[model samples]
Target: MTKIKICGLMTIEDIDAVNQAKPDFAGFIFAGGRHHIDLDQAIKLREHLDPRIISVGVFVDAPIEEILKAVNSGAISIVQLHGNESEEVVDYLHDKNIKVIQVFNPTDEKFNTGADYTMLDSDSGEILDWKNLLIIPDILAGSINSANVDKAIKIVKPKIIDVSRGVETNGKKDINKIRQIVNEVHNS
Candidate 1:
């Protein structure tokens, strides 16, 4: 089955919606962006999250200390590195029993970084050419929503489908959009 990941969750309402929608993963961006949340905010939000849903912390070349703080505080269970983090960083996180998802662009020739999982993202709000890409990713992201989710699944056959803006309305996470995308991914 293709699991669903609702990314960039920054509010208790978002967490509440995901709990109802029942996505497999809920992502929080610690990196500076529109959806970014502070450590304190993440901790508070995690309190409302469904225990069955995994929390993914998205970082962009963040310090290991900061990453550890999130995991140790019980805010995030998995780390998704979205920058030029070294394989040693991945190894370090793994040593601490933290699962890691290494993000790579479609233009990158190599995908292996010794992380627990691989995530492919264009980061450009445009879906990648999955068929032309050489490997089947563990997670596929970038402009994914209910409309194109089925096509993405058919082409990539990814283990997880990640969505952020696609599940948003006016730059905020919309419950209806989340539910619609979740249904699409699960049915696919």
Candidate 2:
């Protein structure tokens, strides 16, 4: 089954919802965004997160030391990079034995990343044509939710599925929506 990841979590409510929904991954943004969280908050949130649901810290061009700090403090179990980090940067982090999820354009073909996994992101809600990329089992993110999640699973067969605003209402994570999306993804 494809993995489900709920990203951009920002509050205690968001953490509680994730524990209940039990998605494979719960993401906390360390980048610039309305949902961005500070290291202290991420650490507090991680303390409450269920151990079964892995925590991912999302970054864009963050320094290596910051990523290492998060991992060392147990604030995050995985790092998802959405930046211009080079292979050398990746190799540096991988040398620390931390997992990395490198984000790329939907049209990218190089597939030359040294990260543990690569993700496709459109920034817009547009889904990528993922048939040919199935061999890599890369993670997929963009605009995704219950309504179209099953279709995404059928078409992308992504190793991991990511969502942010799609699982929210009024700019806050909705428990019902989260559960619905998780249930749908599991059944798909």
Candidate 3:
């Protein structure tokens, strides 16, 4: 079965919604962006998160020490690298028993990051050619929502379907949308 992931969780409200919706994974952005949250906030939010939902820490070229700090805080169990991190970083994280999701573009010729999972993200929510994709992504994430989630699961057939802006309203996570998308993915 394909699992669901709701990303870019920022507030305690977001944590509560995901806890109620019960996605397989919940993402917290450490990377600077509209969804970015500091370590302190992430730790607190993680405390409120459902124990069943795995925490994934998103980073963009962040120092290993910072990543370790977040993991040590018990806020993040998995790491998603969105930058040009070296393979050594992936291996190092694995040594620490942390699963890694290495992000890549559909156009990238090579994807030998050797991380636990490879996620394809356009970053602008642009849907690319799923049929022509060279690799079968472990996680498919780009403009995924309730409307197209079924089609994505049929085509990409990824192990996990990740969403952020798709299940939100006014730049915040909407519980109804989260439940809708989660139901769609699981039922599909």
Prediction RMSDs, each to the true structure: 0.9, 1.8, 0.9
Q: Please report the TM-score between candidate 3 and the true structure.
A: 0.97
For each candidate, what TM-score against the reference?
0.97, 0.93, 0.97
lDDT of 1 by residue, 25-58 (tens): 9999999989899999999999999999999999
Query: For residue 110, what is the lDDT in candidate 2?
Result: 63
Backbone atom clashes (below 3 Å) for every candidate: 0, 0, 0
Off by over 4 Å in 2: 129-137
TM-score-superior candidate, 1 or 2: 1
**How far does residue 18 in candidate 1 sit from its true spot (Å)?**
0.7
Clashing pairs in 2: none
Global lDDT of each candidate: 0.91, 0.86, 0.91
Worst 10 residues of 2 by lDDT: 128-137
Query: lDDT tens string, model 3, 90-128?
Result: 999999988899999877788855899999887767986
Q: Candidate 3's error at 157, in angstroms?
A: 0.4
